[model samples]
Target chain A: MIEQFFPNVNWDTMFEATYETVYMTAISVAITAVLGILLGLLLFLTSKGNIWENRGVYAITSVLVNIFRSIPFIILIVLLIPFTRFLLDTIRGANAALPALIIGAAPFYARMVEIALREIDKGVIEAARSMGASMTTIIFKVLLAESKPALVSGITVTAIALVGYTAMAGVIGAGGLGNLAFLDGFQRSRDDVTLAATIIILLIVFVIQFIGDFFTNRLDKR
Target chain B: MITISNAKKLFKTKNGSLTAVDDVSLTIKEGEIFGVIGYSGAGKSTLIRMLNGLELPTSGTVDVNGKVISGISSGELRKARQKISMIFQHFNLLWSRTVRENISFPLEIAGVRKNTREKKVEELIKLVGLDGRGDAYPSQLSGGQKQRVGIARALANDPEVLLCDEATSALDPQTTDSILELLVDINKRLGLTIVLITHEMHVIRKICHRVAVMEEGRVVELGNVLDIFKQPKEPITKRFVQQVTEPEETKETIEHLLNDYEDGLVVKLAFVGESAEQPLITTLIRSFNINVNILQGKISHTQNGAYGTLFLHLRGDVPEVKQAVEYLEKASVGVEVITND
Candidate 1:
């Protein structure tokens, strides 16, 4: 009965698409995590009343984040096609879809990181300053450590968003479940194949969310 | 070893400008426990922050250990802060870290070697009476235990000065006494100059050698703790003094005594230091032909000395009562005639 319903569902192609989806999500999320954390830290330290307050750096980074966050993901993919070609010398597969995914997601994640850092108590920061801690020490030991659980939660949310973005990358012929579900299942009128792909995508999102919550709960000492 | 000369702070709020710390000057000697007491928004917080260079004074200068802390560059101010540490009412401990890690934080920031840091943290844990609870996070500890961690962390660098910003305000009365005892112990052992900012008069009375009473943005009264308790000049200082003496109840009690004993003089007497513990009431009866009846009395200790107040009923001839009152006054006791019935 299963074979009759999913006659067009090639297991080998489905597995390959699954691999591509994970690959694109992993690489892009990894890049976005590092760049986003740095961008977020810059925004935090240079905020108007922080210990390292610098108006110029704060204003510039805030505008940059706002501009990138304003663009729709589909338009962003098309917009970065020329730059993707220039960077990777190709614009055809999972790897080629990465530049746009990272550029689009990192700024979104940076905003999350900023909110996480801001949630730290002002008194805690003053306590560190009173102890003669340097800016570097505060950022690493106090601010980052205190915000760890929140940062993990932020990263989890970002990772889930990146998963969706990678599937959307199918518009550029990126070989993920999105491409398979859109062209092979939907275009071919194989509604059963589309339903199977949808189930798998839902399962991936649940897994990511579950892992994020587990880590957040374990790390939150407060 | 700290001096402030006409220090002031102005904050630019949405409404024009507000003076947080009005022009004020103070000098704190080494090994002295100086207290600043004020209600909220009275500039006590700003005054304490200025000593550690956390808040820069808009004018005047703050000199600590021969260094001008006000208006200094961030790097220089940070270096100065190494010799001065502070604790908070909330404890302000890093919730993610264990007690030992929190204590070692300053040592780590100062770049003390790992082995030395471990040794120092262990010593501090014992010093603050944490002992086997070193591995416990702040969330697991009680309020008193958290403040112990705060004290240990503040003392990690063996700082010359420890500033306490409403350190006991969040504590219960019993816990506050324990913390105050711990502070007094640390003060004596290390001879560290402690500047305590509190709105609680019991805190000032129990540990401070001298106190500055702040109102609005100015120092309304500054004197030795015993003196402030015995002879408070400002209305704010008098209210603070009443916190320790229970003056409101005493006043009612005095009225009750006055009504009951209509033929005697109702007198209120205050004694300072050794005079409070003296057998002066007996001496008044022995030396003069007067029958003295005690109405209300209490004796409490300050870091400087003991202070006491007494309400007395003198039922003797009016001439003998007047002589007894003069005799008590001559002995350097503070005497006030509440009523001459």
Candidate 2:
């Protein structure tokens, strides 16, 4: 009964593809969250009127983040191929897709993180400083803690975008649901296979959004 | 105790340099509520921020509790800041944290143990009059309650000096009075030196032992709250004193009274300190042969003493009125003849 409506759908391959997509999105999103936050903090701290105001450092970081964020995701993946090969020794598998996926999403997420940090009340940071909080403490306890809801929602948006990037990476031989849809479904004229992969990807996106919204709502005391 | 000697703060903007605080020198004694009163951008905020090194002076020194705040290293400054806490106009409590957690933040920053932090937080919650609401978020609290949380947070590390940067300006009149009372209570109970900056003269009159009036980045007038109210030399200081001393309709009422009673001389009398407590009005009625008609009066109680102004219409023979004026002048009260002009 299950196979009647979708005769061309290979459940085992579909499961493997789904796992690969989830694995890539998960690893890349985790790394992106960390790297993005660090970069964002640097950007925010060095900007005008911030704690560590430095015009030169702020300009350089701002330029770099802007450049990376402006590049098209597919073009970013292609440009990072050589760097990915050097880092991972090959650029074909899910593991190889990570470098490009993170590099593409981190700058985007870094801007989001910077916006989140900016949304925090300046008085809160000043109050923490007046309390003798060190730079590290302000970063972790005040800035990060105060902006937790924003940061969570920001990474959620970034995570969903990363899922799409993973599928695009699959088009370039990084095996995922995208790879199954393109190589086995599209190239082979299997509409059922493409439909199944699309349904699963939508499900993954829905789950990511559900989890993100949950934490965002739970964390936002404001 | 804090001493700001010849302190100056200048900000370099894109257009030019702006002097926020200019060569201001003052000493705040221990266990006293010192207030800096000024309109916005008059450098009062910059002046208070200098106490905790939140804003470093362009030159000169700020000495707080024996530590030179201006000349200290960042590490040393941070260490010194642990003993100098500040609350803000916005009641800047971290919304992510509950009242209890917010109060515990400074203790956490001071590296207190978890058990001690918890105990200190509970004590502060009670101290700020937010006992049952300790678990509530800042957003759940009213403006007054949020400020209480801010005060509790400032008191967490047992700071020797508490700086209030327009702390009660965000609150309503009733809430402002409550917060001011709490500040006075803290100053007396903990013996904490409080340095507060406000545009409201009522705040200074209520809690401050000493008041400094700032105008255009300079300390225009500095004296005891009662003295400043009694004899405000500077124009800005006089304006501030009038805020609490005279109501908006006092001038109109005086003019109206002047027109209504053409035969009497309307005189404005200022009573300060012990003289305010004296029965001068009753004495004038008994000693002088004149019709003493009280027009309007207001008394403001400062931490030092009471300062008030009374308007009276003295009617009778011109010579008798003259005698009454002389008699009133002989007393400690300040006498001024009010004319239609």
Candidate 3:
């Protein structure tokens, strides 16, 4: 009876699709987290009042983030199809969709990172400078360490946003849980499968929220 | 020793050019606990900031032990700063770092090895009397403990000069005393030249060997504490001294006292530096053969020595009143006569 209403609800198919979704989301999220944060830091460092303040670098990064952020995620996926095929020799599956997801999420994540870093205590920077710390030491040792709680909170925000974006990746044959839900449930009229995917996503969100809150509270001195 | 000659610092803010530290020249001798006392916005802090090149002078020279600090390159400036440590009013220790780690930061930046750094941190922890609390984060400590950690951290580089910019202003009076005693002990044991900037005259009296009183970005009175205290020249300096011990009784109070004993004369006397009040008061009555009715008195001991003030209502012949004033003046009592109208 279950198989009849939801033909794709077979345990092997469901687990495999869930595994694929986790794998794709994890890889893209990890990639975006690193590159996005570094880019965000660059934007921050090159802006006014930062250690490496540079107008030209700041203007360039500002424009790039703005341009990328303006483009709709769905449009970005379609627009990258040609480049995706060129890079990976395929535009119809998970591998092709991975780069597009990373590029799209990176800018969003970068913005979040910049906001988080900017929120660090100004007094911390003053203390670091009066200690006669080097510019590099102030950035890596003083700044990054001091902004850890904010960075963790930013990561949680980025990770949850990436999950939503990953669901949209179903458009390009990225066989995650979203693609399974859309293709086998929505398109093929399977209500039970759709309900199951929605429940699973909620569980994922709850886990992310729990871990993020714990780290934030632990690191905060105030 | 530190020598600042014609030192001037001008900052260009949104309001246009503002002279933070005007052409202020002064010398701070080695091993002396020198003080800079001024009201807020008096450039006392700016003058201290210039000494370590934290705020570079717009013109003139700041020579700390023969090296011109204001002209040094950025790298050299960093090295100079390590040699001239500073503690701030807010106790600027890194909140992310533990107390021990904060103390070890300067040593780490100076490239001291890990084991040596650990040993130095341990010594500093003990030196500041924060031995077991070394592992505590800054938030876990009270304001006084936080400043103690600041002192230990500033001493990490073994700097010859320690600049304290309102280090105790944020603390209560009792905490300020303990902190001042700690600085005195550090000065004696480490032979560290301390330049303390404060608005509190009592603070200057308690610990400063030498003091310069600044008003409106100018040093109006400068001398060893006793010289400034016993014979203050400027009105501002007089006003500062008045905060702790008034050298004269108010006219209204003297008038109120004189209503009953209208036959006597009113007089105020200041005693400073090794002038024992007991002997001086006893001698005044004995030598002049006069009755001195003490109206009000406060004896204070400054860093240099004992000093105080006494307001007296003298009942005697006019000739004897003159003798009593002259006698106290000869004893360096800084006598001032008050007549009720």
Candidate 4:
């Protein structure tokens, strides 16, 4: 019954496509989370009278984040295509789309990360400083640790957002569930394929969300 | 010793430049609990921060352990900060780190090894009487417990000087007492030079050996606790004393009190040091044989010792009362004639 579709069900092709989707989302989320959190921390600390207080630095970073965040994902893909191609060699494939995914998600992730970091108790930072902690020590030990729960939650936001961006990336030549649905289900009149793709994407979202919530709950004791 | 000489801190505000600390010069001796008493924003905090270079002096210098802290660079300033541990009014323990981790933070910064840090942290926990709360997070602790962790953290590096900026202001009265008691105990045991900033005179009275009263970014009165409490020169200091003890019979109170003048004299006698506890009233009665009626009295202890004041109305012969007052004066008790009532 399952093999009735295209002679042998194209199991290898489906598996490869799903693997590409997972690889893209995993790599993009990891890179974006780390870089975004770092940028967000620099933004927060620079503004918050830690080590270096540069109003110019803060203004620049703040404007940059907002600008990146405001641009639509599709336009960003097209606009960044030249740069992405320069960086990754092929703008119309899976490997190349990862860079765009990172670019699209970093600013969004950073916004959430900044908000999360800023929400930590000010007293906690003051405590660390008073205890003779250097700027670096305070960042890694106090700021990041205290902001961990929110960071986890921020990562969750970034992941979900990245998933949406990943699906959108399918509009370009990046292969993912959305491309499968669009190319094989919507563009072709295959209702069963569309239903299957929709169900699988939903499952992935639920799994990611559940893992996010669980870690967030565990780390969040405030 | 902590020497702050002509130290100034000016903050640039929207309205204008405001001085938080104004060329403050003071010294906190070794093994003494010195209190910098002030209302909020009175520059006590700024002064304390200047001690370890957390807040740099706009002009002047703070020499701790003979090192000019204000002239040093940021790295050296941080290293200097290790020798002078500061506790906050807010009990600023890191929320993410366990109480043990928070306590060991300074030690960790100073490059103590892990096993050594763990043992030291345990010892500090025991010292602060938080023996079982080593693994608890700041959120899991109460306000008092949090401050205890703060105290432990402050003591992590075994600093020569411990600066407390309104350390008891956020605590309940009972908890404040215990914290004060713990400070006193730490002072005695470690001989740690404690520079405590507080608005509460009672807190100073509890543990401070000497105190400086700050107001509007200036130290108005500076002396030992007993001297400051007994003969507070500044109006702000007097107001603070009045909170704990009744305000002594002022000229106004005396005028109101002296409305009905009697035959005898009303004399205000003050006691300090040995005179404070002496049986002066009994001696007065025995020598002058004057009928004494107590009108008003106030007693307080300072760093030097117990010092106080007593206002009395002598109801016998005027000349006898006068003679009794003179005798009281001769015995080293300060006597002020409030009125001849």
DockQ of each: 0.80, 0.91, 0.50, 0.61
- Over B226-312, each residue of candidate 1 has an lDDT whose tens digit, in order, gives 889989999999888988886577788787777777787888888999888889987988999889888788889998888998888
List the candidates ranked by DockQ, beginning with the highest. 2, 1, 4, 3
lDDT of 3: 0.84
Q: B113-216 in candidate 3: lDDT tens per residue?
A: 99999999999999988878988999999999999999998999899899999999999999899999999999999999999999999899999999999977
Please write out the lDDT profile of model 2 over residues B1-341, one tens digit for every residue.
78889999999999999999999999999998999999999999888989988899999899999999999898999999999999999998899999888998888888999998888888888898997998899999999999999999888888999999999998999999999999999989999999999999999999999999999999989988888888899988989988998899988998998888788799999998888889898889998889998878988888998888999989999999999999999997999999997
| Tens-digit per-residue lDDT, B1-341, candidate 4 | 87888888899988999999997899878998999888998988889888877788899889998879889887887887898998999887777778988888899899999999999999999999997888999899988999999999999898999999899999999999999999999999999999989888889887888889999899989987777766778899988876655654465666765777646777877788888889988888788867888877878775567767787888777687768877887888777776433
* Candidate 2 residue-wise lDDT, A1-222, digit = tens: 979978999899999999999999999999999999999999999988998899999999889989988888889889999999899999999999999899889999999999999999998998888888899999999999999999999999999999999999999999999999999999999999999999999999999999999999999999
Question: Which has the better lDDT: candidate 1, or candidate 4?
Answer: 1
Q: Give the TM-score of candidate 4.
A: 0.92
Question: How do the candidates rank by lDDT, highest first?
Answer: 2, 1, 3, 4
What TM-scores does chain A show, candidate by candidate in order?
Answer: 0.96, 0.98, 0.92, 0.93
For model 2 chain A, the run of ten residues with the poorest summed lDDT: A1-10
CA deviation > 4 Å runs, candidate 3:
A1-7, A43-50, A53-60, A70-72, A78-90, B247-265, B338-341
**Runs in model 4 with CA error above 4 Å?**
A1-15, B247-269, B284-299, B309-324, B336-341
TM-score (all chains, Cα) for each model: 0.95, 0.98, 0.90, 0.92
**Clashing residue pairs, backbone N/CA/C < 3 A, model 3:** none
Task: Give stretches of model 2 more than 4 Å off.
Answer: none
Q: Model 3, A86-198: lDDT tens per residue?
A: 99998766666788888888888888788877887665666666667788887788777777788888888878877777778875687777887899878988878887777
Q: Give one digit per residue, the lDDT tens place, for model 1 in A1-222.
A: 878878878878888888898899889888998999899999998997887799998999999999998899989999999999999999999999999999999999999899999999889999999988898899999889999999999989999998898878985788798888888888889887777777777888898899999999999999
Model 4: clashing residue pairs? B225-B302, B226-B302, B226-B303, B262-B341
Error of 4 at A47 (Å): 1.4
